[model samples]
Target: MCRLFAITSELPCSPMTAITALDVMKEGHDGSGVGLFMTDLAGPWEEFKGAPILSGIFTNKGLKQLDHYMMELGFTTKYKLSIKLPKAPPPGVPKRDVYLIRAYDYPESWEGLSQEEVNHRLMMIRLQLRQMGLDTGDMVVFSFWPDVIMIKEIGDPMTVAEYLGLDRKELRARVIMAQGRQNTNYAINLYACHPFFIQGIATMTNGENTAFVPIREFLESRGFPGYIGYQSDSEVFTHILHYMYYKLGFGIEMYKHLITPLQDRDLECHPNGSFLRHIKHTCRRLTIDGPNCVIGVLPDKTMFMVQDRKKLRPGVVGGKPGMWAFSSEICGLDAAIPDRDKSKDFQPMYLDTAVVGSDRKEVKIWRQTEPLPLQL
Candidate 1:
């Protein structure tokens, strides 16, 4: 099993809070790797709000290739930041070339396109870079989006943080998601890390995805170019979210139904039973099975947590003042936001969607049996 920690706030916050929470749940994960994804960026990153930011690790040769390619594609780097770790590599750690975060100008041809079209182009670029990395063996592009950054590496979460100088650096955001991967399904691959992102939706899971194969096939059959990679079964969580919100145009609450649809007997108790029954039958392959808890954030910054109908994984949701937290364990929450109201905290059970608005001020419990308003 692995541990997941995610927090969203109206105010600028530090990633260290979530990292500390991961430390508290250290026993649940062996730290085979750690994946960090942050959005609504703060500190220095706040200045580049509307521009596209590209983040990844690169080697000298790969860096040159990236620069030439970007220039050819009519992209110019507006600003860039790179962190240099100690030259002496950790004993078992593979040598890293350079870690970078760069803000870039969108291609000239993309200037007049719709915002959605521009975003699609950016995703295509990221996918192209991903293929470039696989071929070159000298670069790894983690993310390319406005106001978002992803850093993933092998090692204990704390050690990885120290290596990146996370605390000393001024990296901060309104939303942060971190996961300490335990490596149950596949060999440790950096791309296989948690906190997977595609388009704008992001998700990380804390348990096995027993329904992954069918889910992958269903998604890939859609013919979306971006659906090709599935290094980890959990990657499907983010894709499932993308499919529901982006492709099917369903509201967030419907996402819970598609993943953990109620049986006919249970559906009969709901006012929207007919519509839901059709959804269940139509998207049966999208349903997830077995023990799993998912924490995800949509493009709008709305955050959510959900448990499988079996409620096999532990999860707790809590909030106070300016923030909300979702974790696999209460200890993790207590570690991140000790002042939060413990009494008001709720643990989402089977088929419950704990949805928190982007502002982090409004939270709602959307259950499988509840009828979703047509307006939402």
Candidate 2:
């Protein structure tokens, strides 16, 4: 099993806080890999919320290719956070020529484009860069989205954080999601790491995805380019979210319905029972049947956690007014924010979806049996 840790706050906090939490739950996961996805960025990145930022590792040659390609596309570099590694990295951490988090200004021609159009272009550019790097193993692009940054590497969580110099004040954010991977289902691959992202949605999961094949087939058949990669079976969870919420124009709550729909008898008493039944039949291919616990952040910065129908994995949400954490273990939560009221801590069951909005005011548990609000 892998350990998942996520935190959201009204004020910017250091990524080290999340990393430390992951360290506390170290026994739950093997030290094979670690991944971090952050948004509502603060520090130096706060001023460039509209600029597209690219996060990834690159070889010396690949860096040149990226520079040339961006210039050809009329994109200009606005700012860059280039990591300076020690001469000798931690024992298990791999050595790389460049680890970059760069923000870029859009092409002059895109000045008046809609946000949706710009988002499409950014995804396309990221895909192209990924393919280019894959051909020669020069670059490994993770994400190219506004106000988001993703860092992934093969090493223990704490060691990777220190090696990457993640303690810097400039690397703060209002929301952060991390995973310490155990590599139970596949070989160790950076792309297979958790905290997968597409467009603006991001998610990480703990537990096996026994129903991976069918879900992958259903998503790949959607004729969407972004749904192509399946380095990890768990990645389908993130794409499934983007499909339901973005492509189908459904509310975020609909995501819980799509992945873990109610049984026939239970649906009979639901207010939207008829519509939900139709959804279950037409979208049956999307339902997941494995033991999994998911933690994610929506485009609006709302953080949420949900469990598989069996509730086989452990999860807890706890914190105070300005901050909240959704962790795979209670110990991890204690490490992230210990001063919060432990009495109010919540452990979501099979039918529960624990959510904390961007305001970070309170934790609301939305249950499967409850009718969703009209306005979402």
Candidate 3:
């Protein structure tokens, strides 16, 4: 039922803008299957082009509130914005849950469905559901972010259990609830972020902007499930804006009035559902494990970087700076390198800092470097 009762009140202040994902691709991004980075986010930013948007990715339980929030703010998307989301997991634990879904498709098949088609499908789902009185997106938060549950452990079993005072035969008979005293506090962070698949072609190669579904093809061996799939808020917003202008005949002032509620809701609840910082810090807390240099903050999440610096078989490493970037620290992307003197044994000059740039869509290699200010 949560999926069937969400609604939004967003009123578009503009016409339905037409566009092609390829049009926003950065130069050299001509389908060079690589990565899109923070810079690549520029591409999406450019495409959005000053359109105020109310975007969010969270799990169930908060869908109803969040949906209302987005609508009041003058935006739209494919979310069951009226229903309460579900708990995705318990606290202090990581669960990479899955979802299944079926989005739209283009005429061509790039391996399977193109990103644009996926985005379109997501957009379409929200609108279709709006008519049906349900929302697939807002309720989707449950797929990822589960509700948090608190648990407690009992200790000193003998003190709390009658079995301790019983005879051997009696004690053996059902040990009636030993260890009933509270010994520890436990809480589960069961929560999931809403899954919004903004389907677009594999455009940016600078390697960034990978939301949920882009990297994982799970939960959809058959069809992407609503709880596990995604929808593009951008497309959803376009539809909403178009509806407000032409369908409902809302003016700029009316739209602005609508947006105020969104802003207020965001101010109260934005940034409630992201785990990026936690993931990043977990990785930063990693150490080198033998031949493998693994860094990760999570007890379970570990990643391997370049092998030992002493190794000299293939590509660049820390000490061997033929063309590699190095900071004084390991994995330092902006490692300061001295002038192009072949006599220096490729050893970078002892400087406090450096910079690097790259044009490669796959591997971003910094082409140049500048020193950071030396503090006395």
Candidate 4:
């Protein structure tokens, strides 16, 4: 167990939005996870080494050096690590199958490729899928067009033809054209810092779908128009880390270590690259997310939150004190439900001002909305 330490300053106000000068849809489709996993990103790992019970892929032989990290400002005294140790986690077979199609080695700017070449490229992608193990359930996250994904045999060629009740041959052609190779070839790569703790990703999903969603919202905000862009999986993840993960992400590494005990140990069922963070970090580090810092997490400087689908207020989070944190363990939205049937109606605490900064200055903000604009 660890003793509580004071936050250096009053917990900073929660950051509501984030959009940087560099817009990268450039990170891997997979982004960071929700909440802090380990105990600490600073100070000593010794404080959390033997805090009761835990297990990990690695025994901490103390051979490698640790990097700085960040997480939300919550405390976990006696916690169980669902997965830990060893940078990567056991992997699992895809729900169906996947494939790495031909590499896209376009010039920094595809100024050279003719439109005809682009068509050939999309057609090649479709043919590649047919040859690869990819099927209806198989997945494909393109390094260039990451957002567009090919989920095996999406849409019904037969369904389309039947729905139109037209010539089977002609209907198939139109249906195929509508669904198109490009659409099936890529997906809109959305990332959220605090992914939801959901059992499975369904047809409708919020930030839990990916780690870069929070900042994505900010990028699409009125403050910035057309600020974010994406083409490949790597650029998408890199842009996410560049905008959001610079400092606080390493803190997530600490969270990663703490949860080492709870992970599944079977080597076959689960393999390396399956662990969420390892997948995200590897995506970022390998440029599977983006080419350079151009595609990366926003540093600690940027603040944002991911609103839980059930809890309208929850969103992507990062920073030190009152740092960005999300939890599936405790359900705030569940608790927020009022006991109207009781003797009295209950309301959550709302402070007009959470704190007074230095010089006794008054800082006002809203809980349901963002602060007013600042004057130049």
Candidate 5:
């Protein structure tokens, strides 16, 4: 199992807060790798929310190639976060030539493109860059989106953070998801790290997906380029979310239903029973099996958590207004936000989903058996 820690606040906070929480639950993970996905950026990045930021590791040659490629495509660098490493990296941390997080102006040819078109173009660019790097083993692109940045490395969570100097004020964000990976299922590949991102959606999972192959086949057959990478079985969780919410135009609440659908007896009493039955039948291949707990962020900044149908994994959400955290362990939550009312800390069962809207004020538990509000 892996340790998942995510926190969202009205004010920008450091990723260290999530890293510290993961440390408290160190025994749950093997410390083989660490991954972070951050949005609603603060500091210098706060002002450039409209520009797409590229976050990845690069070799010296790869960086030069990226510069030339972007320039050829008419993209101009807007702002970049400069990273300065110590003379010697911490023990166990592999040395890399450059760690980049740069924002760029869109190519002049894309001036009149719609937002959807721009998003498609950005994803293609990221995929092309990924393939380019794969061919040469010189780059590892995590995300290419506005107001988002991702980082992953093979090492202890805290040690990796220190090595990257993540404590700098410029790296703060209002929402951050961090995962300490156990590496039980796959070899330690940086691309397989959790807190995976595509377009504006991101998710991290704690347990294995027993139904990975079917789910992967269904998603890949959808003909979506963004759904191609399956370095980790858990990556399908994020794509399933994008398909339902972004492609099918379904509400986020429906995600819980599709992944962990209710039994026929239970669904018979649901307010939207017939509609949900159709969904279950039509999307049966998307159902997930095994012990899993997922924490994800939507395009609108809504953060949510859901458990498998059997509730096989542990998860808890707690904190005061203006700040909240979703952790796999209550001990991790206590480490992240101790001043909140413990009595209000919630652990959703097999039929529950804990959702926190963009406001970050309250957590709404959407029960599968209960009727959803008209607006969602």
Candidate 6:
């Protein structure tokens, strides 16, 4: 089993808050790896909020090639932030040549393109660079998007945090998700880490994904360029979300319905049972079969959690004013928000979709509708 921790704050906060929570749940996950994803970034990143920031590691030569390539493509660096760490790498952690967070201006030709077009372009660039990095084995482009950054390493969560100098880095964000991954589905590959991202959607899971093959096949069939990698079965969750919302036009709440469709009797109790029934029949192949708990974020900063139909995984949601925390263990939340309102804490069952809106200002729980009391 693995441990997942995520928090969204109305104010900017460091990844330490979530890292500390992970420490509390340390026993649940072995010290195999750590992965983090942040959005609505703050601190020194505030000024570059609208610019696309490319986060990655590069060798000395790779950095030069990267700069030359970006220049050739008409991109110019507006700001650059390098995470300064010791020359000597930490024990068991892979040595990084260069840790960079760079903001860039799009090519002149893309100046007036629609946001959708720009997003597609970013995805294409990231995919190309990622494949290039794979071939060279000297650079890794984790993410390239506006106000989003992903960092993954092979080490204990706390140790990776210290090695990265996270506390002194001054990197802060309104939303952050981290996972202390205990690899069971794949070897200890860096790309297999949690907090997977494609475009603006991000997700991390704490349990196995028995339903991965079909889901991967389905997403790949969509002809989306970003759907090729499946280093980890959990990656499918993020694509599932991207497909449901961006492609099919379903609202976030409907994600739970699509992933775990209700039984026929329960489906008939829904207010819009007719519409849902059609979706179930048409998208049946997309349903997930696993004992998993999924936590994810959308481009709009909305954070949500859902569990498989069996509810085999442990998940709890807790919050106070201006903040909400989700974790695989209640103790993890307790450690993060010691003064939180325990009365407001709740565990999501199989059919619940718990959402924390942008800035953590709103909390909502959408439960599956059940049959009304018989007209006796």
C-alpha RMSD of candidate 5: 1.3
Scored against the true structure, residue 146 in model 3 reaches a CA lDDT of 9
Per-residue lDDT of model 2, residues 232-350, tens digit only: 88999999999988888886678888999999999999988888899889889999986999999899999999999989999999999989999999999999888989999999988
Which residue segments of model 5 deviate by more than 4 Å?
374-376
Tens-digit per-residue lDDT, 187-277, candidate 1: 7788999999987789999888888999999999999988988888889989999999988898788888889888899888888888889
Clashes of each: 0, 0, 74, 85, 0, 0
Write candidate 6's Cα lDDT for 94-210 as tens digits: 788888889998889997899999999999899888898999987888899999978888889999999997875458988999999887855688888899998899999988888
lDDT of each: 0.87, 0.92, 0.21, 0.21, 0.92, 0.87
For model 3, the stretches where C-alpha displacement exceeds 4 angstroms are 1-39, 42-46, 49-57, 77-354, 358-376
Q: Tens digits of per-residue lDDT for model 4 on 307-352?
A: 2222322111111222222111112112211221222212212111
Q: What TM-score does model 2 achieve against the real structure? A: 0.98
User: Which numbered prediction scores highest in lDDT against the true structure?
Assistant: 2
TM-score-better candidate, 5 vs 6: 5
Query: lDDT (0-100) at residue 334 of candidate 2?
Result: 92
For each candidate, C-alpha RMSD in Å? Answer: 1.4, 1.1, 25.1, 24.1, 1.3, 3.2
Q: Could you tell me which residue pairs clash in candidate 2?
A: none
Candidate 5 lDDT at 318 equals 92
lDDT of 5 at 278: 86
| Candidate 2 worst ten-residue window by lDDT | 367-376
**What lDDT is obtained when candidate 1 is compared to the true structure?**
0.87
Compose the digit string of candidate 5's lDDT tens values, residues 1-376: 8999999999899999999999999999988999999999999998899999999999999999999989998999999987878878787677888999999988889989999999999999999999999999989999999999999999999999988889999999999999999987546789899999999999999888989999999998988889998888899999999998888888778888889888999889989888888889989999999689999999999999999977778899999899999999999989988899999999988888899999988999988888755442
